[model samples]
Target: MTLKHTILLFTILIALPMVSQDTSSSVSFWNILKSHCGKAYEGSLALPEEDESFGGKKLVMHVRACSENEIKIPFYVGDDKSRTWILTMNDGILTLKHDHRHEDGTEDDINFYGGTASNAGKKEIQFFPADVRTQQMIPDAATNVWWITLDDKTFTYNLKRLGTERIFKVVMDLTKPIALPEAPWGWVD
Candidate 1:
């Protein structure tokens, strides 16, 4: 083989492993989320001193639906059943979206606001910065960064608005799965 061909082949071989590693981590993270597919976990607000909506309310997250490339989780706050989190995986990339609906099962005006993972995160955590759609729909949240951490005992969802004091976090105990709540609004099954 020519010297140039040898160098090219060496470069390709070196890069292949990195890509595979990334894919592995991403898939591992997906599987971790999938593992709780049929369970419901109770959570509590863990950040910010006070919030009108979430504070003093019973928080629950139901990993209600799962598919080969998608998972749907309904997040309930007390009596409100309007929020569902949808995670989708495509080509080893994960996208997070918030699906909000009204009591009548209609999509909210500011729905589906979330972001895609910037890189292959670890098996236990992933970060998603605000995407263009999120920015355009909610200008105040343009600098938002959302992340989730999961383990055998706990799962936490977190959010931070860069350059601001706005932050939110909810911690769920995975060791105790609660009874599944009713389906969120707009969920067909």
Candidate 2:
């Protein structure tokens, strides 16, 4: 065979194994948030309190990233109709803002930070929200927080259900990438 053909054959053989592995399923929190369009997700963050059931109150997420530098995650929970929140998770931390008007489209609950994943093996992550504020909790005393994770085929988010006497936590699991989103401002849309 020609010398060039021999060299090309050897190069292809060496790269075969590496090319076969589909490891790109692993995505970062920043890209995940910035990829949202007009999709609305219906899920609940199950509160861990004995007094409150998993679906007690309501936990739903609305996503939007209309501006160039933003990827917004808006969260709502429970019956007392506690303040809504817009969240951004990236750089290993979660930033949160409170939205009290519920109609005026304002952003509040503002806090930015970095936190480590306590339950890494369980495909779970917990991030710091703010200081001296009341968040959701379980009767067993687990602080409800923003949790993120990615598995072989899906991405998941868990938000704690914040309340006064009820103090509980809730979880939501999303199974579709097209449904979950990849950009906060939704570059593709």
Best-fitting candidate, scored by lDDT:
1
Which stretches in model 2 have alpha-carbon errors above 4 Å?
A: 1-27, 49-58, 66-68, 77-83, 88-94, 102-126, 129-146, 149-168, 176-189
* Residue-pair clashes, model 1: 0
lDDT of 1 by residue, 1-189 (tens): 999999999999887855343577779889988999999999899997599989999999999999999999999999999999899998888899999999989999999999999888888898999999999999999999999998889889999999999999999999999888998988776
Q: Report the C-alpha lDDT of model 2 over 1-189, residue by residue, as the tens digit.
A: 999999999998987875332222222444454454454455554444444433555555556543443445555454322343444433334444444432333333432322233221231333443333432222322344555553433334545434434343444444432244332221234
Per-residue error (Å), model 2, residue 142:
15
Question: What is the TM-score of candidate 1?
Answer: 0.88
Candidate 2 achieves a global lDDT of 0.42
Which TM-score value belongs to model 2? 0.43
Q: After superposition, how far is residue 130 of candidate 2 from its true place, in Å?
A: 2.1
Clashes of 2: 22
Per-model C-alpha lDDT, please?
0.92, 0.42
